[model samples]
Structures are given as C-alpha cells and as structure tokens.
Target: MKMFLCFFVLFILGFDDSSSQGNVNKAIKILTKQVKKLQESNKANFEATNMKIETLKNESQTNVKSLDEKITNQYETKVLKLENLIEQTNLTKMDVNSLFGEITNQTEFLLKAMDYKLGILKVGNAECSQYNILNEADRGISSGDGDNCDSTGLNTSPMWKGASWYRFLPPAGTILSQAAPGEDHCGTWLSGWCNATLPTVPGSTLDIEICFDYSGFQCWIAYDGKVTNCGTYFVYYLDNIRDCTVNLRYCGAN
Candidate 1:
C-alpha cells in the first residue's frame, strides 16, 4: 500500500508538468503570429507614406514648370511691343526731317530771285538817266513792271486771282479763273505762270508772284509746294496747292 501511494503521487506530478509544457508551447505560437502581423502592417504603412511623398514631389515640379512658362511668355510679349514702338518713332522722325528740308530749299530760292530783280532795276535806272531816247523808251514804251515779265510792255497777269481781283477780266490764255467774288483771296493759285515752266521741274526754283488785291495787304504761299510732272497742268497745279496748304491757317494781318 505504501508503494502504490508513492506511484500515484509521482504520476500526478508528471501529468501537471506535461500540461504546463503544452500550454507554454501554445502561447509561444500565438505570440509569433501576432508579431508577424504587426511587421506586415508596418511595412504597408511605410509603402503608402513613400507613395504620398513621391506624388507631392511630382506635383511641385509640374507647378514650377508651368509658372516658368507663363513668366517667359509675358517677357517675350513685352519685348515685341517695345520693338514696335521704336520702329514707329524712327519713321515719324524721318518724315519730319524730310518736310523741314523741303521748306528750307524753297526759302533760299525765293531770297535769291528777289536779289537778282533788285540788281536789274538798279542797272536799268543808271543807263536811262544818261540817254534821253533810252530813258523815254524805258519809262513809257517797253519796260516790264515786275520781276517776271515778257519782252512786250504789257503787264503779266498773276497765276491765281483772289477774291479782290476775281471781277477783273484776265487776258486771253488764262489757265484758272477765281471763284470768290468778294474782297478776300483765301484759296490756292492754279496757273502755269505762278508755277515754274522752262527748265523748271517740280520743286525747282521759280519766281512766283502772289498778288493780294487788298489795298494794303500782301498774300504769300502759306507753305512750300511740291511740283509734279503730270501731263495735265491743272492736276499739277492742284497737287502743288495741296502741299502748300498742308499746315496753313487763316490769320488777319495786324
């Protein structure tokens, strides 16, 4: 009986040890599975975070490129506009210079013609005082009155008739007739005499006499006229008048 009781106690002790070892083995397996699951979750989160970072980098690069293109386009447009303005300014300056040159040439020619007329008048007076017949012929018979005259004693008519002289009848072969009948000649002169004829081209130095029939007022060309060699004399005259009056305004003599 003592041996049997001892054997039963030993069996109970062995069974308890076996059961504890089995429970330990099961707990170790469950902990290992949980560790594996946590590792996988962490790896997935890391991949998702990396993808978001890459997306943000790509978006920033695209935005920068777009902004650079817009800036480049704006600068190019501004440069083009500036170039156009410069070209326009250069053209305007050239036009102004050309007009000024034409006016200067006309003025010089007019002055020289007046000086020649005065010298001729002086010579004629000196020669006439010594000889009686020559003086008589110069005074009464064949001396032309103004600077521009024919060999005959008859007075040469002006090219344009103003309002003051419109009523007066011109001699035969008159090219233009005056329109206004009153006492003011505020229009253009359209006759061949006023224009340069022999050896005279457009813009040539010609002696032009502008007569204002007003008692005390004189008329002059308002601006320089450009001559053109059109077959029709009337057309050439009109073109010259148009150029002469380009910048003219009426102002009463004080």
Candidate 2:
C-alpha cells in the first residue's frame, strides 16, 4: 500500500514540474516576439531619418545653384550698364571736339592784320607777340639797330632778336622777301624788311598755323593748316620767342 502511495505522489510531482516548464516556455516566446517588434520599429525609424537627411542635402545643393545664378545675372546687368555709360561718354567727347573745331575755324577766318610801326599796333605796354604784323618791302619801312623798329614810334618794337627776318605773303604762300639788320637790305634802313604781296581775290583769306615741338625753342609754320613748305622752323634765340602764334599777311603794301 505505501509503495502505491509513493508512486502516485511521484507522478503528481512530475506532472507539476512539466506544467511549470510549459508555462515558462510560453512566457519566453511572448517576450521574444515583443523584442523583435521593437527592433523592427527602430530599423524603420533609422531608414526614415536617413531619407530626411538625403532630401535636405539635395535641397541645399539646389539652393546654392539658384543663388549662384542670381548673382551672375546681377553682375552681368551691372557690366552692361557700365558699357552703355562708357559709350555715352565717348559720344559727348566727340561732340565737344566738333564744337571746338568749328569755333577755331571761325576765329581764324576773320583774323585781322596788324602794322607794328608808327605806333599803329602799340595800343599799350603790350608785347609784339600779341599782334601778327603785316608788312611789304616795296612800301617804305624805317629801320635801325636793336629796338629801333621805326622812326614813328621808338617803343613800337617786335621780337627781332634773331639775325634773319621773315615776311610771308598770301595767295601762293611764299617768303616774298627777307631782311637782316643792316642798311644794305632789300628795303632801305629797315630793321626787318620783306617784299610781300596782297591777296587780290576779295573773298580769299590768309590762314596760318604753328606746329610746336615739345622742345621749348622750336616751332614750324603751316600754311592753311597744310605743311607744304620746308625749312620754316622758328627757333627761339635767348629764350624770347617760345610761344606758337599764327603769323599771316594778306594785304601787305600800298
């Protein structure tokens, strides 16, 4: 009878152990399923984060390109504006030059002749360089030594520091006559004498031009703005005649 009781108790204990083990195994399977679900959720969130980062990177690159395009367009617009301004400035300069050239032509066309002797040109203490003298050798001209230009006016002297004197004529531009400081000159008793011709045509005008060199003492003459004659260099002696002035003669003598 004891052996039978012992076997029943042992069977009861074994079945209890087996049922506990089964419950433990079910609990473990449930916990494992929950862990796998959480892992999958984490993986999905990571992928989403990566996708957001990629989108932001692409957006940043596009923004940069757009900004660069805007800047380039602005720069090009400014450059075009500057070019237009430069063109306008050049046009203005050309117009000013044209106006100045016209005024110069009018002034030269209406130039008047001046006689340096008989106090005719000596209105004040002004120098001879102010007036362009017109003289003819056939007509009488008084002459003497230094500063003695004529007997009429003792102070009416010109810049005659050089040895040779030149007198130009109009129509066919030529040195009609030349003189030196002596009594034996072509014109008698003349500090400077020249046989000059007067323009016969009524509308013809005497035109003279001076082309100055960079050196202070040298200049050249041009007839009617044309350099046709050679050896017309005007050299200053004692640094006296350094200025470039037009000296033209049309009606020279009586």
Candidate 3:
C-alpha cells in the first residue's frame, strides 16, 4: 500500500509539469507572431515617408526652374524691344525722350529679375542735386510769344503755384541723360532739353531739344540722348509747369 501511494503522487506531479510546459510554448508562439507583424509595419511606414519627402523635393525644384525661366524670357523680350527702338534713325526728339523713359523702366525691371535669379544685391541710386529759379537775363531763352510755359521769361513759383523752370546737374561721370515732363495743365505742354560737355581735349558739346503737346492730357517728353564722358559738366532743363520731375542715375567712372 505504501508503494502504490508514492507512485500516485509522482504521476500527479509529472502531469502538472507537462501541462505548464505546453501553455508556455503556446504563449511564446503568439508573442513571436506579434513582434514580426510590428517590424513589417514599421518598415513600410519608413519607406512611405521617404517617398513623400523625395516627391516634395522634386516638385520644389521644378517650380523654381519654371519661375526662373519665365523671368529670363521676359527680360529678353524687353531687351529686344529696346534694341529695335534704338536702331531706328527717323526718331524725333520726343521719341528719344520716350525711349529714355522706357529704358529707365525696363532697366529697373531687369535688375530686379537679375537679383532674384542670381541672388545678388542691387546697388543704390547715385547722388543728385537740383537747381531752380534760373536767372532769366542770363539763362532764359524766349519761348517766343504765346508760349505759356517759358514766355513769361521770369521763373514762377513752384509747380503747385503754376509754371516754373528747373535745372538739374547729374553727378560727374554720368553716361545717360533723362529728361521727362512733370505735371499737367489745361492746354499746356511739357518740354525737356539737355546739354552735355565731353571731357576731351577739344571738349565738344551736345545739345538736345524735345517738345510734347498736352491737348489730350497725356504728358510728352521733348528730348532724350546719350552723354558719354559727362565728367566735365552736364546740364538738363525742364519746364516744371507741373510737367517735369528729376532723377539722375548711371553715374560712375567713365
């Protein structure tokens, strides 16, 4: 009887041990499956993120290229127009002034576009000075009778008060002259003129005259011309009868 009881106790303990081992094996298998699934999910997410980043980078590059191309084309078109205008021979003084004004505007546009494309900073404008109220007896030329702007022979007050005359001297080493009309009055017109003395042994001088009609309220420019070696002296005149404004640019070493 003692032998049988010992045998039974041993059998019971062995069975419990076997059952526990089976449960542990099943749990391990489930955990392994979960870990593999998690790894696959993480890898897929990483690859998708990388793809999105690459796509955005390519799009950004394409957009920048397109913008640069557009700006370049526009600048080229403006340059061609200017060249054609300059090549014309039958241009009047008024036509020249208009061309100068157009050149100024186009140059500004080109500079800005170049700044954007090349990542370069633009230079500031050159220094300038203005002179008003000329001596009639010395510098005034009779606009002849019936000329409202210059006929008075005496410079009036500022343009806000009425008609006036002004002189502008650009900085030394100026390469171009710009003279344009200013304000508008009833049945009145704007006029511009320029005189530049070259820095040569003979010291030749160039004179330009321009006239604009104000019948329909559109302002006109009288004259525009180039001034090389304006290092000695340059003088531009305007009838500021609400008809002229002054600015000097492109001044540097000859």
Candidate 4:
C-alpha cells in the first residue's frame, strides 16, 4: 500500500510540469504571430509615406516648369513689341527728311527769277531823250530839236505804278525807292516787278526771314513760292519792315 501511494504522487507531479510547459509553448506561438503582424503594418505605413513624398516632389517640379515657361513667353512678347516700335520710329524719321529736301530746291529757283526782272527796268529809264524840267533854264528839252544840246537830253523821270512798287516793299510799308530785284533786307528775296504770268504763290509770303532754335531745322518750298518750316523745329518769321501779322500752321509740337 505504501509503494502504490508513492508512485501515484510522482505521476501527479510529472503531469503538472508537462501541462505548464505546453501552456508556455502556446503563449510563445501567439506572441510571435502578433509581432509579425505589427511589423507588416509598420512596413506598409513607411511605404505609403515614401509614395506621398515622391508625389509632392513631382508636383513641385511640374509647377516650377510651368512658371518658367510663362515667364519666358511674356519676356519674348515684350521684346518683340519693343523691336517693332523702334523700326517704325526710324521709318518716320526718314520720310520727314526726304520731304524737307524737296522744299529747299523750290525756294532757290524762285529767287533767281526775281533778279532778272530788275535789270530791264533800269536800262529803259536811262534811254529817254526828251524831258520837262520845272524851274530850270532848259525846262522843256526835246531830243530831236535842241539848241546847244548834243542830240541827247536829260532822261525823263520814270513813274512807278502801285502794283509794281507793292512787290518790292515788305508785306507792310511804303516803297522808299524804285522797284528793283536782288535788293532785300535781312537776306530775303523781294519781288520788284509784277508779271501776270508769274503770279505769287497762294498762301506764300516773300521777304520774310525764318529762323530756328536748333541747327538741324529744315525749310522747304511748297508748290507756291513760299518757304515752309519742317521737322521738330521752332520757326520764327520776322518782318522788321513793318508790324506784319502772320498766320502759320504748326509743323510740330511747340
């Protein structure tokens, strides 16, 4: 009976130890699986974060490229517009210069025509052989019948007509002397003789001096025999002979 009881006690202690070992093994297996699941979750989170960072970088690069292109296109458009403006300005300057050249040539020709008419007036007055002098001894002198007069008598004084004298005088003022060409004051040409064929140019004045504030100011001749101011120049037409009024058109801004 004592041997049986000892054997039964030993069997009970062995069974308890085996049961504890089995429980420990089962707990270890469950803990290992939980750890594996946690590791997989962490790895998935890291991959998602990396993908988000790569997407942000790509968006930033695309935005930078778009901005650069817009800026380049605006700069190019501005440069092209500036170039076109410069070309147009240059063309306008050339056209103004060409028109001014034609005007100068016409003014010179008109001045020459006036000089030729003056010489004829002086010679015709000198050849008159009969004259009537008041308050002189030889009062009534005749070229054909004269005693002690060597076939030639003093010439009669020539009378100037109103129309002929008006040509020589400045726009205002009386004629102080006989009408003559190439005779002017202040370097202007005067009309001494009137010819119907050579009518004065309409809207043009003679014997007027045109001065400028700058050196490159140009003057041109119109279809009429008058000088016209050209370019970006200030023109002053002075008439010292009289208080003459002038109506002028503005060529450029004052």
Candidate 5:
C-alpha cells in the first residue's frame, strides 16, 4: 500500500515539471526496491504456508492410523475375554458336577471317573434316568448284559479276557465290538472321543455326547444342542493303543 502511494506521489510530481526530474528518478529506484522486497516476502510466506499444510496432513494421517490400531486391539481383547469367560463357565459346570458326585456318591464317582456314556437304566434311586457306566463290578446294573458290558470278571460270562478301567478314564469310549476282548475294544458305551469342549449349563451335570472317529481322527463333543470340543486331541489317536477306539453312537440328539 505504501508503494502505491509513493508511486502516485512520484507521478504527480513528474507531471508538475522536469525541474524535479532527479527526485523523480530516485523515487523510481525506491519503488523498484520495494517491489522486489514484496515479491521475496510473498515467496517466503507461500513456502511457509505450504510446509504448515503438509505437516498438518501428515499429523492427521498418523492420528487416523493410530486410532484404527487402537480400535482393532480393543476388539481383539474383548473377543479373547469373552472366549475365556465361556471357557471358565464350562469348566465351572464340570467342576460342580464332579463336586456333587463327590458328595453324593464317592464310590460311584470313583467307579465312573470321567466316563461320558451312561446306562439309561430303570434305577431304584437317581436324579436322572441316565447313569454312568456302572456294572456288576460296581453295582451289577447296566443297559445291556455282556454284549455291551464286560461282566465276565464278576461271574456273569466266561468274559472276553481283556482288562478294566479302559472306559473309566478321560475318554470313556467303547471299542469292544470293533476290537478284541482285551485290546482297547469298543465295549458298549461307544469309544472314539474327539477333542471337544462339552457344552453345559452351569451348576448341573453335563449330559453331553463325545464321539471320536479314528478313521480321519475327527471328534465332536456337544451338549445343549451345540458342539463344544472338536480338534486333534480327542478325535484321532492310534499311536498309543490307549486311545485308538471307534466311539460311534447316535449321530445327534434324538
């Protein structure tokens, strides 16, 4: 603005006369210097503004990435916590059942151990109709006599001539029909257990089905109309004759 006013003053003076010609020339030089300075100042300001804009843009991008990562981590954490909670709930249910078994029938539990199959029996006294594998060795009560049971030891039959405690352990699978008398046979309760979490309602006995297919080693353990455990551990194992049984039973709930 000052340059414009000075140029106007110089024009007015020059129009007055050639007598002030020297002063007019000096004014022109000063105007030229001011214009050059103004151009340099504008160039510097433009560069500075562009740098600020670029910096702001970079900061915005970084903030967006950070926020996205934070949100993703939070989501994963929540999912893991929910999974852990569900697992704990299932474990607690089993714990409660075992606790009741301990309090109500210690001997029965000792005989049954971790057996899954039940003898759908007409019992004298029991909370549910289905009962774990209890036989002449334990109580002389079973679903089928010797065909599905190993009652030879207790004087029921000549016996298949094998062993006991096979169905009383973790896998409660029965391979008696498929296997021989003594070698890990599928006796009656259906053997081949797969890696499956047993779905259960809290504070109740788990009436879940666990089946293991040794062919391809696929296992399905389910309860409450949902499949729980399905993996390598429970489904397929033949290396140690301990877990190489065909645990096939009713496909799904009837």
Candidate 6:
C-alpha cells in the first residue's frame, strides 16, 4: 500500500511541472510580438519627419528665386523710363545733373545694369591712362600727339588735376556745326578745325564729338549751332576745321 501511494504523488508533480513550462513559453511569445510592433511604429515616424523637412527646404529655395526675378524686372523697367525721359528733352546742365543725381542714389549694381542696357561706352582700361598736352602755334587747330593715352583718330587732353577732355570722330554722314568755346580752365584749348569728310558724301562735314567734364561735373551737347548741357558727355559740332583739339578735364578723377 505505501509504494502505491508514492507512485501516485510523483505522477501528479510531473504533470504540474509540464503545465507550468508551457504557460511560460506562451507569455514569452506574446512579449516578442509587442516589441516588433513598437519598432515598426518608430521607423514610420522617423521617415515622416525627414520627408517634412525636405519639403520645407524645397519651398524656401523656390521663394528666393521668385523674389530675385521680381526685383530684376523692376530695375529693367526703371531703366526704360530713364531712356524715354532723356530722349524727350534737350537737357540743360542742371537737368543732366539732376538726372545723374537720382541715378547715383541707386546701388552700384543698378548703375552697371543701366549702362549695359543703354549700350553706352564707359572709358575702358586702355583709355584711363594720362596724357600730356601738345601746344599748337595757333589756337585755330591742333593735332593729337601719338601719346600713350591717345588712340588713333582719338585725341586725349592732359587730365588736369581737376578735369578731363576727349575728342572722337563720329560716323560718316552726321552733320555738325560750331558751338560754345572750350573752357579756359581745361589747361589747353583746341579750336574747331576738321579736315576729315564723310567717305560716303564728298566734302560733307564730319561730325566731331568733344567730351569734357568740368570741376562742377557738368557736360553738354551741341546740335547745329546750339550747345545744351546734356548728360555725362559733351558734344560740340564744328565745320571745315583742319584739326579739332579740346583739352579735357576729368571732373572727379584722381
């Protein structure tokens, strides 16, 4: 009877141990499934955040480009208006100065843009050098000395410490007549005498453009026989003068 009772207790204990082991394995599997779901959720959130940042970056770049284009168009419009104004009037010294004063208020970039748009010639590096005055026997006509600063067909005057002067031959068939006399302050004076004629029309008077900038930063233009203080350059029309020379004074140049 005692051996029978001991065998029955061992069987009961072995069955209970097996059942406990099975319950522990089921709990581990449930915990592993929860961990994988959490990992996937975190990965999705990270990718969404990166996508939002990239979208904002692209938008900011597009806005900057649009603003730049708008500003450029506005500047171009302003240049067109200025050209129209100049063409409509015979600008006096004060008128020209007033125009340039407004222009100078703009930034350097705008000035360069306006210059290019107008196709105006800014003295190049080759034309910036200084030159000496060549005295003439008579104030009637003076020829250009082949100096470092004087190019062929162009005469340069000594950039007096306070002024600048220049003379250039215009294209053929352009009409020109004498205007005001050159300022005495320009170191040397060259009279209006041009031997050059239009190749297209024999004996036709050649147009001579004389440019000068005074201490007051004034410039003028001569049409027919009248002198009108125009923009940044001076123009003087002359008749059958053998040689044309005018001393130029660089107004604000160092």
Candidates in order have lDDT scores of 0.36, 0.38, 0.41, 0.34, 0.39, 0.37
- In terms of lDDT, the poorest run of 10 residues in model 5 is 228-237
lDDT of 1 by residue, 10-73 (tens): 6545565447776656655755666677788889999999999999999989999999999999
lDDT digits (tens) for residues 1-254 of candidate 2: 44754665565455654477776566557556766887898899999999999999999999999999999999999999999999998999999899989988766533422222232332231221222322333322222122223222232224233322233333212333232223322222222222223332222323333222112322222122211111121111111222223121111121
Clashes of 3: 7
- Stretches of model 4 off by over 4 angstroms after superposition: 1-19, 95-254
Kindly list the per-residue Cα lDDT of model 5 for residues 1-254, writing each as its tens digit: 77786767767575755467787777778778888898999999999999999999999999999999999999999999999999999999999999987777765543343333343322222223222222123111122212232233222222222332122212232311121122122333333332334423211322233343333334333211112111111111111122213222211110
TM-score per model over all chains: 0.33, 0.33, 0.28, 0.34, 0.34, 0.27
Candidate 1 clashing pairs? none
Q: Candidate 4's residue-wise lDDT over 1-254, tens digit each?
A: 44754665465455654477676566557656666777888899999999999999999999999999999999999999989998998998898788777777677545443443443222122112122211212211111111111112222112211111111111212211112222122112222111112223322224332221112222321111222121111112212221112211111110
lDDT at residue 69 of model 1 (Cα atoms) = 94
TM-score of the candidate numbered 5? 0.34
Of 3 and 6, the candidate ranking higher by lDDT = 3
- Stretches > 4 Å off in candidate 2: 1-19, 96-254
The alpha-carbon lDDT assigned to residue 223 of candidate 5 equals: 15
Give residue 245's lDDT in candidate 5 (0 to 100): 34
**lDDT by residue for model 3 over 1-254, one digit each (tens)?**
44754665465455654477766566557556666777788889999989999999999999999999999999999999888877664466678899999998888766655663464642221211322323222111222112234432333322222232232222222222233223332112332223334333111234444344333422333434332222233323333333223211111111
What does candidate 4 score on TM? 0.34
Report lDDT (Cα) of residue 47, candidate 2: 96
Cα lDDT, model 1, residue 233: 21
Q: What is the lDDT of residue 133 in candidate 5?
A: 29
